[model samples]
Each structure stands twice: as structure tokens, then as C-alpha cells.
Target: MFLPPLNPQLGLRRQLKTIVFRIPTRESPQKPAPPMHDPASTWNTLKDILPGTDNTVATRVSENEKRVLNVFGAPHFALLPRPEPHRSPSPYEYFCTVNESASHVEQPRLSVTKLLTDAWCELQTFYDVFAGLPSARSARLSSGTRHHENLEKQAHPRVDARRVEKQIESAAQKHAPEAVEVLFGTPMAAQLASQWSEHVTMRLVEMADTCELREIHVHGFLDLARGSLVTDAAHVRAAVLVNGVVDLVRVDASNHTQREPWLEEGLLLVDLSCAIPRAKATMTALSKDHFVHVYDVKTRQNDTIPAQRSVLDAARRQCMFYSRFLADLARDSNYAYQSWLENGRRRRVEPDAPLGTGNATELLLRHFETLALDYLRLARGTDLGFDDFDNSHTHRQKQNVDGPEHASRYTLSDFVSAAQFREMLAALYGQDSPFLELDVTPLFSAWKRPLTLRYFAARAGQTCNILEAVVPGSVGVEYHNMHTRRLLKRMHFALDGATLTAAVQHAASFWNGTRLPTATDDMKRCVYCLYKNRCPVKNRATEKVGERIYRLCESQDGACENLHGA
Candidate 1:
């Protein structure tokens, strides 16, 4: 039979999974034990018995000293000792307190790497739970089996510094010089940077290397700035390919310039708005009022829904996160800061503020208000539904493993049991209904949030180019969303990145002697080639002399009898 333990400390707090015990014969006690040692002194005496345990009294005194100093040095830094749950104040309270404490400005030196590592830990925690990935150490227990050991053992292993350093070094070699430095504090950042490096090295390395292009400049707001073109043709080609729309503007120094032009012969005018990285996911614009404004072409139209409370809440959160992240970008590199000055010279700039973070607070608040209004209206009584989808979720999950055994094993069967859907819908929609939907949606449902997959590309101009070369004849302003996912997909071919680099090299060799050979070599027989068909890169195996196959197919005059020889 289960019984309670007789420890006074245990009586105060009930720990989960703790063993319980009780005295068998309380009435039979004839005499009380000799005066027990004082509770406080006894606790102190036992402290040294625990391995690696420090003297609590000394630790507490030190902590108190630190707290006092913190208060005296910068009162704003003296946060109250948070309770167990550790929650910050409400948004209003938080902002008010921060504003009130603005008089004492103390810029504590922050370690970017430490911040990144913490963020990665949080991200992994969320992803592991959300994606339902199999834990490396989940174990089966018999009925009535204790779960303590299993639970403790199932945790993801801690990362080692050496492994992290290796990843960082790899990232520096492949993606960009700044990638390694920018990833400080994020554990997954190192892994992600390495992955980006591998991909960039495979696809963009050869093209850039052949053209004698060196570095890629990524603008914090607009897009990218490309460097190292050996010839004017290469630069023009890069400018055309990198940008979707050529913004007609003079490159005046006073107006501010964030560009790195090798030749100052002419004003550098390139498209900022249209150039989207190929691997970006589809995007849909919505009004501040939560109205459906536009749909991204790649997403399924049927799944696109109007902004509701949930949508707006998510948007506000996203905008704030992005704003903060962009703020960090300014401090990450000299180029980013320069670009901000050049592009935003006309805007009212802050002298002391980092460019990215300059209007972050206001922008975040404004965007949140706009989204909130839309959500409020939708929640009141708006009849609207959203429908935009793709098999991207499935595709991403598939990337974790290589073969049939590694395929998307997560089926609907895994989540149908329990009150999961009902609980979720209740939280999201504020009501339970038979019409409520439940399925594993993509991890990134909103455009404002960062994507798990990133597209690493290299071009003649800019660090993060936004042009879409997937479907030809739709150049310039015709390109669509250039989010992480879309940019990744685009680089698969044009960039021939880490995973597909070998395939591109082999393809380049196959079409060495043919006319328009490089195109044929790069597109056909290439694993990364997503647009082999109708692209000049694909081999002309079916083409015959004097035959206009492309024109014949594109025409509306019933496949041109003369061209087809019908």
C-alpha cells in the first residue's frame, strides 16, 4: 500500500513521481526520540553531503550582493526575482516600466552567440513537440512502470562546443563571411549555417567563381548587393537576374548609398521590389482591417482564409519578431548598416539607433494594431474562410530522412486519439464545433514568420537576390514571393547548392560541346534542376533543324501545321 514520507520539507512541496511512505505503528511509540537537531542547522550540516553542491548560505549571500550592485549600478537592470513560472509583466505594463526606466540607459554587453543558442533551444523544443519527431530515447514501459527514468533519459542530448565550432567554421566557408558570426547564441544556427554553406557551395560557387565574383551583400530591408563581376556583361547580367524591377533612380552619394559598386561609371539602378529569392514561400497580403487583399500564386487558393483574431494575433507577433531580428542585422555586419543608410536616407533616420531597430518598436505596434482591428471585426461576425496550401509540409518532413524507411511516417492516425483537436479548436476559435478543422498544417502558416528551410544563393549582385528564374518568359516584375522556402527551391538548380552541387558539375560536363551548351548542361541531368522542361538548360534531344518547337507550342493557332510538318 502507498504511504506518505515523514520529511518536513517534503510536506511543504509535493514533487511529482515521488515515493510515498507512512509509519506503520504510530500508537506504539513509548518515548520520543532525543531532541532533534535544529531544522535550519541540520539542513546546513547535510548540504555538504550532496556532490557538487555549494554552501547555500554563501551562494545566497553572493546573490544578494549581486542584486544590490545591480540595483545601484542600473536600477532598470534590477528585475525582481521571478517566481517559479517566470512570467514577464503584461505588454502594457512592460512597455510602461521600460519607458519609465529609460532615463537610466545601460547598454549591457550582450553575447550574440549566447542569445542565438537560447533561441535555438526554444525553437528545437517547439519543433520537436510540433513536428512530432520521434525522440531518440523514447522507451516503452510495462503497465504500472515508473516513468522517472524514461522521462529523464528521453531528453535531447546537449550540444558540445567543439561540434558547434565545426559547424560555424563550415558555415563561414560556404554561405558568407558573416553567417558564422551572425549565428552566435543559436545552437541550431550553426547547423543551419553549415547546411546553407553546403547548398551555396554546390549551386552558386561555380557560377560565381567562373565569373570572378567574390562576395554577396544582403540588404536588411530591400534584398541584396552582389560583388565581384569580372566583366560589364557579367554585372549587367547579374543586375538583370538579381532584380525583378529596375528602380529608375540616380546613384547620388548624398541621397545615401548602401551599394558596393566596383565601377562608378554609371548610376546603379536595380529592381528591389521584384527580386525575390527562388526558395521563398508564397505570400498573401492582407489589410490592417484583416480583410483578404491578395493571394500568393504558389499557395492553394482554396485554403486561403481572411484574417481573424488568430491570424491578427499571429501577424502582430510575427511583425515584432521580424522587427527585432532586422534590428540585429544592422549590428551583424557593416554592409547592412551601410545599405540601410543608402536606401532609407530620405526617411527620418535616428542618429543613435541602429538602422534596423530604428522604428522597430513603433512599426511593431502599428502593425499589431492594424492586425488587431481586422481580427476584432472578424471575430464579431465576419463570414470568411481561408484556403491556400501546398505539399510543402510533406516535402520538408521528407528531407529529414533519405529513403523509404525515412519517408513521411506521420499519418493522421497518430493524432486522432485524445481530445487534441477539440482542445486546439476551442483555444483558437473560442468555440467547439463539428465544422472545425483539424489536420497537421504547415509549420509556418504565416508569411511574416521565418521558414525552417532557407535558400542559399550566390549572384553577381547583392547578398540575398530576389529574382525568380524558375519559369522563363516571366522575368522582371512577374516574379512572386521570395520567402525562405521559395528561395531554397530556386537555388536547387541555379545555385546548385550543397546537396545538388555534384549533379550540376556532371551536367555541365555532359553538354560541353553543344550550342547553348552551359544551359543544357546545368538544367538537364542535374539533380537540383527544378525547371528542366521548356528551359534552354535542358538538352534539345527532340529539336530538329529549322523547327520552331517552342513557338509552335506557345501559339494559339492550333500547333502551327507548317512548324510541326503535319
Candidate 2:
């Protein structure tokens, strides 16, 4: 069983409790504040500008509408046709490596697994550089004054103010027509809103104590206003842990300390706290012979063990599958370069191997060690389908094997069935299962089940449906809505949004403690009223809002439990 941390209070258990505490504290209301009769104050209050109900009023706009295309504030559209079932090329076809005996090759030059590993490693490095300690030393960005001096030293161009203004107005009309009105209506004032929320402040501070690099200069306090939306110490700590695991596995595999790259990669990033209630299942399943030890929190005992084979294999396979699942995200996308860089960086110093090696542990490790070379060959053994194969190495009898497809070897319709997978796996490693005999139905179930568009996009890849582009079909309203909902849920959490967005934008920046920026204008203008500036969110909208709320609650002594501050 997964050993709980030595102190029984230092691992995922403590962290989860902190997350649960992020929810607002509950108390019986003794009295209510007098309704504000002041119009200005009412408008400023979140309760006034919107409906109390959850129903959203936003509707999809026409392409010709004179408004900025803000994804945030857009209405749901049910008009698009449904996306067809995804038709992935056989997994073997895309990611399989060729054998050494092969004389010809047609697959992509690089090993897909290596590419994924490299990308994962770079992501970790980025997190390490910017995450961890808030005050860790690194390159500092120029501040408001320094930026102005640099701008002054730059070359200037003479321009007609009237003409320039006219051009700007024209551009606004063509581009951000909706924003133009909003910009004009508001005063020339803006706020650098923090992303950190109230719930994570204390945890962030605790996490910040462990990092080596630091980017934040502001102090992070649990009671600080609008702190949840801003980056904090806890975020950095989580990123380091995640990236560290991934990087470690890659290092292990490269150095011959581990195998099964895909499994290792997958497990490294799983949200264990949310996935399973306790560490027991993970530890027992992953650890073979080694006993899981919990060291005392105060006393540093070296109890961690060498990476287990089953754990490594499962991790590596899962990671590759995840990457393959997200292949749609990599194609013709801006992140392609970053993906390439990450892939290149993760590789071991050893030579590359081919894809599609037969099912054997020694062979798998050997092949993984020489991935670059093996992948160049694109070898497929003499098997049209995994179904016909038996456990014995030698065929029971010489049957008449005939048909043009069999003769050509070029007709690729090889599919791996469940039985075949089981048989092959049994053959490859000879039945010494390292994982605990826990029900893994859920693991397969999650993947086997049809997924919403957003879930597919968020977890697998942003763009899995290549057919949507080629067929020019619409994502059905129901599917789109489902996808949107799933995606929104994933995005709502601080960890997922921050990490994914940071990965997209800075490839190197680990999203550990970073907060998601404010919703886009469209989201801000959505038909739904929740999460708006005026709503009673767990964390206050702006720093001023928190400070005011704190003061107001504090003044009304004993009226609210939160008067002491949550």
C-alpha cells in the first residue's frame, strides 16, 4: 500500500484539507446589512448589476455583429453540426517503432515517445526557473520607470495626429467594435489585479519556503485581498513537484534506472489528490518488493526507493498514450515549436531505437534505450492482426495463409484487441505483475468512454478533430455545450488553468502557483451572472473589495463568523 508520509500529516492528506478549506466558512446569519439606497454604491455592488439566478442571458452572436469576439462573454450556440467520432490512425501506425531487421522505413523520423519526454522535461525546467521561492534570484523584468527610459531612447516617427486618430477609430470599428464603446465609457484608470485567491494564501506561503527560484516580489498573506487570483507560493510548490517527477522519470529511463517511459510520464502528472482519496492504492500498486516507509516529518529519513519496473512501464505507456491522444493539439499549431523543443530536450545521451518492437520487457528497454535509431525503421512483424496470434512462439500448425492483403504487407489495418493485448503483455514480461491487483476498470473506462469536446481538448489535445477542419462541419449544440461545460470546470480550478495557460504561453514557465488572468471580455460579458465582479465569490473580486469586505465584517462584531477573516 502507498505509505502515508512519516508524520501522517505531511502528504496529500494535508494538501487536500487545505483545498477543502478554500470553500467559504459557513455560519447562521444573525442579521442583514441595510439595503443600500445609494445608486452609485448599488451599481458597484455585485448584487445589483445582475440577476440572482444562475440562468445566463448571453446568446451567440452573428459573424457580422459589431462586437469584439470575446470568448468569455459569448452566448452558447446550438447551431453547429455535431463532431463525428474521432478516427485516430492505429496507435501502432503513428507511434510504433520499427525493428532492427527492417530494411525500409516510411514513418516520421523522430520517436514520438522521446519527443514527449523532451517536452515534459523542458516544461519542468521552466517551472524550476520561475517557480518555487518568490524571492529566488533570476533575470528581473524592467519596471514602469525602466520601461519608459527604454522607450524614450528608441527612434521616433513623425505622424499627423488627426489622421492617426482616424485610422485608429477605423481599426477599432473593424476589430474591437464592442470594446470601443466600453473603453470610451470608462475613465482612464485600470488595476493590475492579482490572481491569487484567498483559499490558497496560507498554503502558498508554506510552499514558498521550499523553492530555489523566485519570481514574485509581493508578500503573500492568507488574509490578503484578491490574493487567490494572483500567483502564490503554493502554486510554485506544486509545479516543482509535478515537473520534478516527470524530469526524474526521464532521467531514470535515460540512465537505465527505469523503463516503461509512457507509464512513468502519465503517473507523474496525475492529480492524485483528486484521483484517489488515499496514497495507499498508488503505493501498493506501484511498489513491488520495497516496503513503503513513512518518515517522521521532523526527522529526515531517506525512505524513497529505486523506481519500480511496473510503475515505470505503466507511467511511460500512459504518458505516450496521453501524448498520442493529444496529437491533434500538436498539428499545425503554434505550440508545435515548443513541442519540438521539449521533445528534443528530453532525450537521453544514448542512440535512438526503432518503433514496433515485439512484446518483451528486455526488448522494450533495449528499444527504448536506442529509440532514435529504431523509430527510423518503422518495422511491423508478420501479423495482420493481434487476434490470430497465440501464446506459443511457434505456430501450432502451418495453415494456408493467403490473400492479397497478407501478401502485400502494405495494407495496414492492424488492430490490437483486448485478448491480444493481454496475451502479448503476458508473453513480454512473464506474469510478474508489479502493480497491486486493484481494479483498473476505471482507467480503461475513462478512455473507452466517449468524451466531451472540452474534455478531449483539455486533456488529450486542443484540436483532436482534424475532420472538423476538413469537413467544415459544426460541433452540434449539445456536444458543444457539454464540451464547454467540461472545459469550464477544468478551467475553473486554479491549478489546471494556470498550468495549461502557462504551458501554452511560455512553454518553460511551470504553472505551479501562477493564477489565471481575468476572464476575456467575452467571458466577462457572458449571459451568466456568476463569477462577475459583483458576485459573492469565495475570494473577493479586487483587492479593494476584500479590504472593504474585511472592514465591514469586522466592524459588525459577532455578526458573522468571517469577521475574524477566513
Candidate 3:
């Protein structure tokens, strides 16, 4: 017969002795001798003799003493349980809070990115937004950001410091000679002078016509009930504020090739001198207009070139959303004009308030002013005095050219006034209104056409393997290897109005609190997800812990066991 060991911590000799003495032989049943030392006392003695044992024992003793004192002295307080911590608000609630503060609306503001992310994996997006987790930084993201910044720099090139200083000196000589000393006497003064000119130069560039516009900001609201752009707040089932930046707006004069013969024929009989043309006179008004094409660039890792079906779908929706926003802004001339005027008026009244307090118009204006002031302060070492400029007049009065002696010093205030600035804004808005009307079509109509998605692969900080996808048009998606430049695979499809609408509505339902965020059906996505460890919906069967793997078993308690042991 076998006997199990009683005291696991005992020495082999001591355990054998205890066992031998306890087992009675076939001879006679005798009274058992007592143990030389109590098992508990022996364990206590061994614990005291071991290294670091005193510290551990002291800690345990102190904790026990404290517990005893608390029970005896303040039993009522010690027995009381802690109130449960306030539960964190859900993603939808957090969104509402942000919306109310920014736009003074209870409705949540959704971005093209957010909508796409929701479509990709609503559960992941929920954790991202609710927990406010910072996006994981990787080489691919950094490469893409650097590339975009380079592209934007091409549009608004830095002003030459030498040229700016020369202009400042010439202006000072003509108007205020003493002002030159104040401007160029110190390094701080000289720096500020350069910044002022740079700001003015950039503003001029923005007002002027450019063939390619990078990072054009756009925003508007979508009405869920009518499936149209929201204008008034009244009689709305629900409104979702959508905003996004157009990566690139290429002014293509070639769009005229797509113009129908009937459109051209109709335009020939209409009057050409009118400022605003009728709907039928689209071609005539568009004669001088250039078509604008929106492009969104996505950077991917080497393996992600031939993206999954879900990723491709998300990209298509993102581009469509951007195109739709641009079209809405372009088609509604009255709204755009009014928004510009209202924002400018508000900006004038409360110049100190933050940007993005109103619509995109206010956001743009405030951004310009803030940047201008920042540059000036960096150069001049002081706030460029806004009080120096006159705001009494609605328009700047033309001064006599002959009165050089009477001319004021060259300051940003003298270069542009509040009313003049507003006019410049109007002109900027006016330039694009006609072009957007002629080039952009409604979302439903535009979706019928094939949208292109370009995926760039980066290697050693350089981008290559430009894979382009013509959705709904091509049969398969084609991937190009970054190093070898070899074609990998092909795939393609197009979007329809109903499909796009359904996808958007499904995503909106989650945001509107109609349903909770659902986990992605694609198990592959969960493998690399940052929140997989904590996600309740994660596939526990495939969960890897150190060198071991586990699989969920169909037990009543829903327990998981090691695969090796199973």
C-alpha cells in the first residue's frame, strides 16, 4: 500500500520517519510516540531562518495587528464596505459631451475617419474613443505623416527671409524711417519682421487661384430622416455632424472632355454676362471653371498592400464621404456665403475666443489669425498691437498716393483691416463656389462612378509599390511588392447608393444608442488588436500566454484549460 506525503515542506528523512512510525506493523498495535516538534512550530522556525523571511514575517505581523486594532477599536467603520466607483460613461455619452461643448448640440459629431473606423471594427473604435487611448505609433504612420507634410509644404512654400527684410527696409524708408530701427535693431525684432511677411504671403497664396490644394478642410451635417444635407435644426429626425479634410484637390481642366454635347449646345443660347447662372446654364458658368478631383492617400505595411475586403470597403466609403462633403458645400452657394459672413461678423465681435467655435468658416478664419499672431510674436517678442488698426469703417479708404510723408508705418493692421479681411474671405469662398458647382455631383450620382484608392508601401523611409484600386470597376485588387516591384494580386468592386446608405445608417445606429458596438466578424483583426487582451469578445481558444496556449471548454462554469493538459 502507498501512502501520500503529509507535510510537503518536511525533509525526506523526517517525512519517512513520521510515516514509518505511524504505520503499524503486523506484530501489535502500540501507542504512537509524539512528534519531536509540532509541524506548525517547525514551519515557523524554518521561515524565520530563511533569507528575507524576517521582512515577510514582519509585514504579515504588522498587517494582522492593524486588522485586529481596527476590528476592536472601530468595528463599525471597518465592517462598512466601500461604495462602488462611478461607472465610466459609454462612448455615445462622451461623444455627446464633446459635441455640446464644441457645437452646442446634443448630437454627436462624426468624422470620415470615425465612420470608417466604425465600419472596420465598431468594438475597437468604441474602446479607442471611450478610453481615449492614443493611437499606436509605428514606422508606417510616421512615414505617411512626413510624406503628407512634404506635399503640403510644396503648396505653401516658405517666404525668403532676405526678401522679407528688404521689403521691410524699403517700406520703412518710404513711410517711417525710425520704424526700421525698431524693426531691425534686435534679433527678436528681425525675426518678427520675417514672420509678418511670411503670414501675409501665405494669406495671399490662399486667396489666389492654385491648381492643386492640399488639406482642404470641409464640414457639414447629414439628416438621417431625409437622407440629405441638414440646413435648419427644426423638423429633423437626427443630425450627424460630419467633417473631414480633403487630401488633395486637383484642378483638372480636362473635365471639360466629359461634358455632354447637349450641355454645350444649351449654354451657347444662354446669356454669358450674368454673375449667377441658372441650373440649366451650368455649362456656360463652367466654361471658365476647372474640375476638382479629390484624392485620399493611404500608407500601408508591406503585407497590407492587397488589403482585405473590409479595409477596401472602408477606404471607398471614406473617399465617397469626402467627395459628398465637397459637393454639398459647392452646390449650396447661399449657405456658404451666409456662413462666411456670419463667421466673419462673429470673429470681429469676439476676436479673443478660440477657433472651431462655429462652422468651418470660423475655424478657418480663427486658424489664420492665430497662426499670423503666433508668427509675429515669435519674430517681434511682443503682441502685434491689434488696437493700432481702425475698425470704425466698413471699408478701407484709399489714401492719396502723393502723400508719402503722411503715410503710416507698414504694419499688418495697415495691410489689412477687418472689413477688408472679410472681403478677402468672401473672394476666397467665391472662387471655389462656381468650380464646385460645375465639377462635383450629388453623392448618389457620384457613387455610381468608380472611385480610385491608392495604397503606398514604405521601405527605409521611402514610399514605393503604388497599388491603385478602381472600386466597382476592376475585377481584382493588384498589389506591388515594395522591394521587388512584383504584382501580387487583384480585386475590385463599385459602391451603390443603397449600399452606402445602409452602411452609414448601420454605423450611425451605434452612435445614436440604438445598438451596442458589435465585435468584428473577422477573427484575424482581433489577433493584432491592441485591446484584445481585455476584450470580452476576444477568442479565448486561441489566446496565447507565454509558451502555453489555451482553449475554452464547454463546461457549465465556462472555464478555460491549457491545451497541452487537455
Identify the leading candidate in terms of TM-score: 3
- For model 3, name the residue pairs that clash: 191-379, 192-379, 192-380, 471-493, 472-493, 472-494, 476-490, 476-491, 477-490, 477-491
Measured against the true structure, the TM-scores of the candidates, in listed sequence, are 0.18, 0.16, 0.43
lDDT of 1 by residue, 225-317 (tens): 221111122123222111011111011112221223211113121111112121111111111111101111121123233333422222222
Where does model 3 exceed 4 Å of error? Answer: 1-90, 96-108, 134-139, 155-212, 223-240, 255-292, 301-304, 338-495, 540-566
Scored against the true structure, residue 263 in model 2 reaches a CA lDDT of 30
C-alpha lDDT of candidate 3 relative to the true structure: 0.38
- The reply for model 2, stretches above 4 Å from the true place, is 1-330, 333-345, 349-351, 354-566
lDDT of 3 by residue, 1-566 (tens): 56666665764433334434466567865545533423344435334333322222211223322332232253321221111222234344555563324432322456677666555677777655543343457876676676666666677654343443343334345445554443333332222222222322222223223334566555556554344556532422245556576665444454432322212222211111121122113323333544445566554445456346777777667766665555544443344323322222221322111111011122123233223222223123232222121221112234332244213232333223334334434444344432123211121121111110000000100100000110111112234343343444443334356666776676555555455667688767876665553454553321232123112233324333332223
Top-scoring candidate (lDDT)? 3
Whole-model Cα lDDT of every candidate shown, in order: 0.24, 0.23, 0.38
